[model samples]
Target: MTTMDLHSMTGAYALHALPDDERAAFERHLAGCASCAQEVAEFAATAARLALASSAPARPEMRERVLHRIGTVRQVPPSAAPLERVRRGAARGRGAARWALAACVAAATAFGGTAVWQYERAQDARHDAARAERQAEQVAGVLAAPDARTRSVRVAGGAGTLVVSAGRDRAVFMASGMPEPPSGKVYQLWFDDGGTMRSAGLMDPGRSTQTVLMRGAVDGASGVGITVEPAGGSRRPTTAPIALLGMPA
Candidate 1:
């Protein structure tokens, strides 16, 4: 069978609707196929949800009706030669039950898929909110420093400033009168701690006055520098720095 054929059977396998032999074959196939395994897991979860939804207490009249039907129903032995028609009727009944089950599973899968999507969206939103909150706190701390110092440096076509907190562990960079860099390049910030250089953050070249929070600690840094680097910035300064300024002692 083609891979597509095998993949198509995942729903049936998940619902245990596949015959015993086909079920065993699909199980072996599932071990080697990551895509099929994921699909099966999703379908299984949906089936579980369906089972939970079906666990509600039955109505009293419905229970009584079921009991009455069971009491009135007659069992016929399959070995009875004259009962061939009864066997055919039983087969038809089984077919109807299978169709009903397939329909229920399809509905449950749709609901489960929607639930999973909503959950993922909520998680992403929470992550973004938390990140923004942390950044705000950092900015507040630096701005509130009792002895925060600012240094201005001249760039090729503009100027920039470095604001370092009194404690010296955090800093922010603000650029002004600066023109955007050429295409395929970006402005990058760096902290020179003692003699070692560390990447601080990336600045938007298009903005004439852009403020960026430094990514690296500047506690013992002697100075800060801005350099033009390839898009996405670089690990180390690769081009001549556009501006450099020393921190106050």
Candidate 2:
């Protein structure tokens, strides 16, 4: 390859995407090009991080695909061909090497994709953790309020406690051993502003113990309630509340 072509090959060489001949040429070029060498080092570092989250099991289809590709490779038979065919063994060997190179390229491309997926997953996890931390801080602030008070609550199959803080204009509703909602339904929380019930949020249908910080301002709200509602929940309560704990005066 020309020097110009070789200059652009640092990325491909770093990914092992180059054929043996091209890779050899690139290495020769890299020896004289400090910039290319530095870029290759950086790419190698990125490749290293790609496997950090690879502890998770690979999909079954990935294994199957590799097996299928290997099965299709042309391998020279062991000493069964004519003399001329035997002499051409080197050609067949090169073909097999080319196939191996293709497999390496495929693997490198897959690794890059997995790295991107893992990065996005990590970002999402961090965002969720930060949000949870903020919510926990809010819950703690309410509970620590000077006027904070607790009220007992009871539902059909479980009991709970409501900690309200007029000073903070917030409250936390925590319940234990709550039954899963009916099929095609979910449990929803509401804030009682005078007699009007405002939607707070939905509960985890699969979880029995729930800790929820009532959504929206509890400034004028007097109590909180939980009820069964259709999946996705309603703008307002459509069924009777399973439990209600009044705000302390």
Candidate 3:
């Protein structure tokens, strides 16, 4: 093969797009040609960056849109006249070579941007997963505590259970058969430490059975209470509690 033909095949070789026979031939040539070997190394690095970018999850419709575009787009071949002109320009002062290098630089820049965006998205996914795991472990610890005590409380339309571990200062609240709250209202949990009540958090009432780790201190709480309040909840209970359970004496 001519020197130019071998040089042009470096990109295809780096991308693994060459046929088996052509790839074998290229490898043999690459062993002796320092310039072609260096070009292949740079192209391989660019391909790795593009691969990283494409590893991210795509939107649901992205596959359909990409396939539609591929089917509709027309491929244009380079005209001999323009090719001849470019050859003449390159013969004079390497203008065509500079243009090819510029095109490679632009492609590399685009791939670099995609790689950075995909990396950030991967990091965010990892953080979300880690946070969820920690929350699950906290709930598990409260449920498995050997010193934990549990009590059930009956409400107007449903029943709930409170499990507390004084050794861990943790508590878990679970509700069953609870109906959805009225519009603009939610169920809120409270921990009664002596006679003072502290907010736990708003509960999800739509669930037939729901379990959540209480956010307030359980170490000194005498009992647990659930009350109905406006959406986003209130600093103090706005209505009489739906259920209350005293801790084991």
**Top-TM-score structure, candidate number:** 1
TM-score of each: 0.61, 0.57, 0.52
What is the number of backbone collisions in each predicted candidate, taken in the order shown? 0, 0, 0
CA error at residue 110 for candidate 1, angstroms: 4.3
**How far is each candidate from the true structure, as Cα RMSD in Å?**
14.4, 19.2, 20.8
Candidate 1 whole-model C-alpha lDDT, 0 to 1: 0.75
Best of the two (1, 3) by TM-score: 1
| Model 2: residues with Cα > 4 Å off, grouped in runs | 1-45, 48-106
Q: For model 3, state the Cα shift of residue 68 in Å.
A: 54
Worst 10 residues of 2 by lDDT: 117-126
**Residues 53-86, model 2: lDDT tens digits:** 4467889999999999899988876665676686
Segments of candidate 1 deviating more than 4 angstroms = 1-90, 205-208
Query: What are the lDDT scores of the predictions, listed in order?
Result: 0.75, 0.77, 0.76
What tens-digit string does per-residue lDDT give for candidate 1 at 111-213? 5665454334333434555575677788777877887878888877787777888674789887788988889999888888776678998887688887778
In model 2, residue pairs whose N, Cα or C atoms come closer than 3 Å (at least 3 residues apart or on different chains), thus clashing, are: none
Question: Over the stretch 107-190, how does candidate 3's per-residue lDDT look in tens digits?
Answer: 766666554443443334345555656778998998899988888877667878888888888889888888888888899999
Can you give the lDDT of residue 9 in candidate 1? 87
Q: Which model, 2 or 3, shows the larger TM-score?
A: 2
